[model samples]
Target: MAEQINLDKDDLITFFIHHLDKVYSAKSHLLKRLPEILYQVHFSDLEEAIFETIKVVELQRKRMAAIYELMGALKNEGSISGLTGLIDDSFEEIKTHQDNPELRDMSILFYMTNIEATEIASFQVLQLLAVKIRKERIKELIKENYNEAKADKALMLLITTKYLSTV
Candidate 1:
């Protein structure tokens, strides 16, 4: 049987709050940037997938907001470092492949999946932290986002193979 972790609940809560702010901040930024990212792709399937991703992000933001309401924690007050670089790299990828539409579309898929993969790891951490801190409701909310991130990653993988065959 697995032993229960002996940790300072206060420290774990603080740690959870810090990352919660980071991910929520990142999701807010990426939420604004997603439409632009979606505009970069030309394929119907990829565009559809991106539209679904935007919907998932919107839901994720609301989920995090609910958690914040529960904790009485305010959102990040300043420019916080999180997933900005990954989003920027998505634009850069689009720009670099301008001469080739297929490559541009493919690169967008690659970078977006990269961002979602990072988010998956982040959400897993948030979930684990919630468990450690004994917040079952928050853990459940984060799990929805975590599972969506994983599903998006798998969908992106499927789109990659489809895009490649068409290329």
Candidate 2:
């Protein structure tokens, strides 16, 4: 995992893009298994929960799309290198935003807080793939250029509040 990344914002963005692609691929593979799970499970409640989770995945896909937009904006402006420098110069920016537990909680709640909240089978698959991608991305950052502390900080930001459990 540590072998795959360069320690720069552009590199990080590229790594995440690739990682997301892998995740999407893995999820596509897992989608085939969903029908089996859907069949064997007798509980209608569980079925609904699984359906809701799939909806959440769709929402997450949109979020990733937005992230890609930001990535594109950075690239189009020729700011990727500058952005990397900014990230390196002000590591505290990401940290300060993440340190507020209330903000973090609210953000997560805002995303998933809805009627009929239940455990979704699709979440397990998404969670596993997301974790793997994050782990690999961070490991790559750690190995190539950044100091241990900076690499660790980058990992923390990647996990953020939303992905902490998986991280």
Cα RMSD of all models vs. native, in order, equals 2.4, 19.2
Write model 2 residue lDDT over 1-167, tens digit each, in one string: 46784466556556556544443333333233334333333334344544544554454444445544644522122232322333223322323435564443333222222111211222333334434545453333223212322333333334344344433
User: Model 1, 45-88: lDDT tens per residue?
Assistant: 89999899889999998999999899888877336344766677
Model 1 RMSD in Å is 2.4
Clash pairs for candidate 1: none
Alpha carbon lDDT of residue 33, candidate 2? 34
The per-model lDDT (C-alpha) reads 0.85, 0.37
lDDT of 1: 0.85
The segments of candidate 1 whose C-alpha lies over 4 angstroms from its true place after superposition are: 1-6, 77-80
Identify the leading candidate in terms of TM-score. Answer: 1
Q: Residue 111 of candidate 1: its Cα lDDT?
A: 86
